[model samples]
Target: MFDLPPWQSWEMFGACFYAVRINALLVLGLSTVTLGELLPGTMMSVKTRSISVELLPSRVFRCTDTFGASSPQRISRQGNPLETIDWTSGDWIAVNDDNGVGVDIFFTLKEAATDNVVVFVDQRKRQFGKFQPCHAKDYIDKLSVCPDFLVARGARFVGGIMDCVSPSNLEKFVVPDDCFILSQAGTELFTALWRIIQRVRLSSPSTRHAKPPSRQCFKAVRKKWIKSLGKL
Candidate 1:
């Protein structure tokens, strides 16, 4: 449920759980949202494009036979695709591989240059079988698709700025009322992402010089979504 083209697809909802990155940091989403507060230092680590993290309480568990994960807390354990379309391509991007790792763990390739902003979804060998280039409108009900994962207990979704990961210092990010791009952090994050997209399309992929957030440098960039300014 987390991956889809934000400009297109079911992901028109702005940001999502899958397909995330910011200043080179990967995103971690959770389906088990908590109404209560979690303690500090709680985290879940991922082995992806970057060694990303997801902060959460230990009440949740990973999606494996064992209750273990990188961090002490239980992992929700789960969780996108596309390329060469419009910036607002109303669809999410992903890559297909029959013998690949899986879309839930897929990341944008450094060399798979395309003329469009793309999200890479690695189709799992056992689940989706092989990946197909699709969009939000396609709305395939196949396993590991965005819609299904969003509703899945342990899976996380990926998409746009909404699909970014939180620093270890912050709590697990919960999507705000309108999504956070209007805030200072959101503005910087997406602006950088857009620049990266442009560079990639031009076949000159290089990230901005911004440093990752340190504990002292971190900022909670939450913002209220406003329907008047635009459509999600």
Candidate 2:
């Protein structure tokens, strides 16, 4: 006779617990790949009676078991996680000029084994104001504009804004030419928005220049935007 723990016994009763409901029905049948001989603790505890099961390529999915087996968890949210890509998307867009000199930003969910959602900014033309993906080098070669130079210029814009607005040095805020090289497409864009927020704070006489709350509604929103860029 196999004796089960309290939690196991309760879970085995039915799908009464939230974990049971989430894992068993959602993930479906799981197969054990490892073959382990019954050890001392194997039958002693329900948790020990488990074998490691891999759910294909590690896309995090929630798992539940009657015997309280460990399982991967899936994210359930209101909308598609990829759509919230503001910081990186905006950053790539900002680097490109309005005249279509640089790359155009676009993103789509690549439904591969692990759901490789990629955000890319490529320089290409499309019909009806659409963006098409092309090689970064192709865009640079066709436009006769050095990609390195563009990156440098964008970095300069970001550093200059930060220096100008920073409380420590407003006067000696020289925008570095190589700032863009140091800054990636996403980081530069995020910095730009942060500067904008600071600018708005400075301009408004009534509003005190207090640091943005670390844990607040706006910060939470910023986090979601950051997640799109895969920056956490």
Query: Candidate 2, which ten residues in sequence have the lowest lDDT sum?
Result: 34-43
**Ten residues in sequence with the least summed lDDT for candidate 1:** 31-40
What is candidate 1's lDDT per residue for 115-193, written digit by digit as tens?
Answer: 2222223221211322122311121222233333222323333321222232221233332221111122232433454
lDDT of 2 by residue, 91-158 (tens): 21112212233332211112223332222222322222211122222323343222343334331111
Candidate 1 lDDT for residue 17: 24
> What are the candidates' C-alpha RMSDs?
19.3, 26.5
lDDT of 2 at 46: 31
**Which segments of candidate 2 are over 4 A away from where they belong?**
1-103, 106-196, 205-219
My TM-score estimates for the predictions, one after another, are 0.19, 0.18
